[model samples]
Target: MTTYPPNIAKLFEPRPRLKYLEHIDIAPKERSTPAVSGLSGYLAQLKSYDSEIQYTPTEGPIQKQQRERRERQRVQQAKVASDLARWNPSEDPQIQGDPFKTLFVGRLDYEVTELELQKKFAGFGPIERVRIVRDQRGKSRGYAFLIFNSEYDCRNAYKESNGMKINERELVTDIERGRTIKHWQPRRLGGGLGGRHYTKTRVWGGRTNTFGGPSGPRSVHQTRTAPRFGTRPAYSLRLGPTERRPYERQASNERPERDPRYGGKYGVYEKYKDVKTEAPYKYESRDSRDFRDRDARVPERREREPARDKKEDRTTRFDRSMY
Candidate 1:
């Protein structure tokens, strides 16, 4: 190791070129050795293990006992009443302030302190209190709560401070919804508004993305920089019933638009539906005078024949049998 200069300024000074240092012999470069594999490498590894694993053999029995003890402790801890009820939103007594006026600040840095949180958010409103949740061992759980004096202050803080960086971590802030929202469950129990909000679980196969993919096109609202894109109406999430909309009921009282491919008509040559004309289709007409295909394939209508008396028909059938 080279010795450092006693003075800080001497460190920045350029090094002097000595004759002996310049004449020092340097080794020629050589290619790095290729890695070995297959049976030969396996044998080499086996040879090394005999000496390397000597320390582990003596510790095995001790380690086994420790593992069993740890497992038993974990099972015992899980049975404890406090441990079982640890994450219950309603039952936690340490939670302070009104749910409406308190902000549940999550995604916090583990090192951030309560005093720092209080001071950081002090500009929003008068902070009633600040609490950074900790585990049984007093390690920060990367979440905290800030209690504001009023709901307005809480709302302001929630709006402005969410996604704000503190201690190199983006904070996720929201109003305490445990009491306000029904059937509330924390993230640990598979429910959380913040973490899930950032998730890419949004269904992509909407009108804009009929056949979605990994690099699908974004919706009009997302891509547009301005509030309104040209003269087009603002994009809406609600199932559309607006004018000139497709695949849904129209909001207007105008005439129902037909298929544009068939010239806004249901029939190819004649009118299928006419509320004003009351014209019926050719096949639907019962008028025999009407010109229509009556081929075998088209099922031609037959003339009705006179009905014979049952007695006469029976007599004819008996005569034929006698013959």
Candidate 2:
């Protein structure tokens, strides 16, 4: 018979029934006292049940994976934000002095919107956002602003998008200026009292008062018309076939005499004759009939004195003869 340690036998006997059979058999076999029973399996089952029944909570694999994913996303977002803040255009030699990170897209179709701008510029790099300018009526103003995630992307998009065509129109893309621009307004060509108030003025005899003096409101009676002869300069008359002397413009100290050749000696009568003529007052010429009226004013009154003698004496001659 052989004997084994209690601890060694405990290792070989796992079941209670197996331990009992080992104790009953004694035929030239290695035998020993069974130090332990099959309580380890029961203990494992109890441990599992205890864990299930306990109040303390535990996360599953799926929940643990989801938490890890959310943490990673948060960290990535924070890193992106910090990078944007720390990015210095002055430090980058490639950026030069122009630190603009926005692209000014012009000549865009009137129908193009914010989403179209994003779709077109996104291929260049990561875009921060897109903004399309609109008017007071909520219509697209045919331009947009594209902001990128980095300076390189901004420059790249600017270079590549220049002269690019969309909706059959070539686009003009450039680096955005740092200043704010006023919204575009159509130039007002016609408005107020100055535009529609223009009258079609006709200048007569090739003469206009355009450069003469300060313009005053013209009355219907103030217009002075030129003579039918011509309006050539007085110097030009010297060059004509008539070869006249240079007209000497002298100042007169005495009042000019009214000749019978024109109208009459009376100023009022002369003006009345001028007003009855077709010519303007400033250019009225002498009339042949005016000379005939000059003699008729005086001798015609002496001839009218005989008319009174004829009427009174005709009746008196008969009465005197009877006396």
Best by TM-score: 1
Tens digits of per-residue lDDT, candidate 2, 1-323, equal: 13778877777776565443444667656657767866767888888997789686799999999999999989877876666566443454433222367787887999887887788788999887687878889999777778788989998998888888888888888765433232321112111111112243434334432332345664322332233334423222112232344434444655466555664566547667745534322214432112322344443332222122334574565564355
What are the Cα lDDT values of the candidates?
Answer: 0.67, 0.59
Q: Which 10 consecutive positions of candidate 2 have the poorest summed lDDT?
A: 185-194
Highest-scoring model, lDDT? 1
Query: Which 10 consecutive residues of model 1 have the lowest summed lDDT?
Result: 289-298
lDDT of 2: 0.59
Q: Please give each candidate's TM-score.
A: 0.38, 0.26
* Model 1, span 93-197: residue lDDT tens: 897678898898998888889989988999999999899989999999989888899999899999999889898888888878778898676665556665533
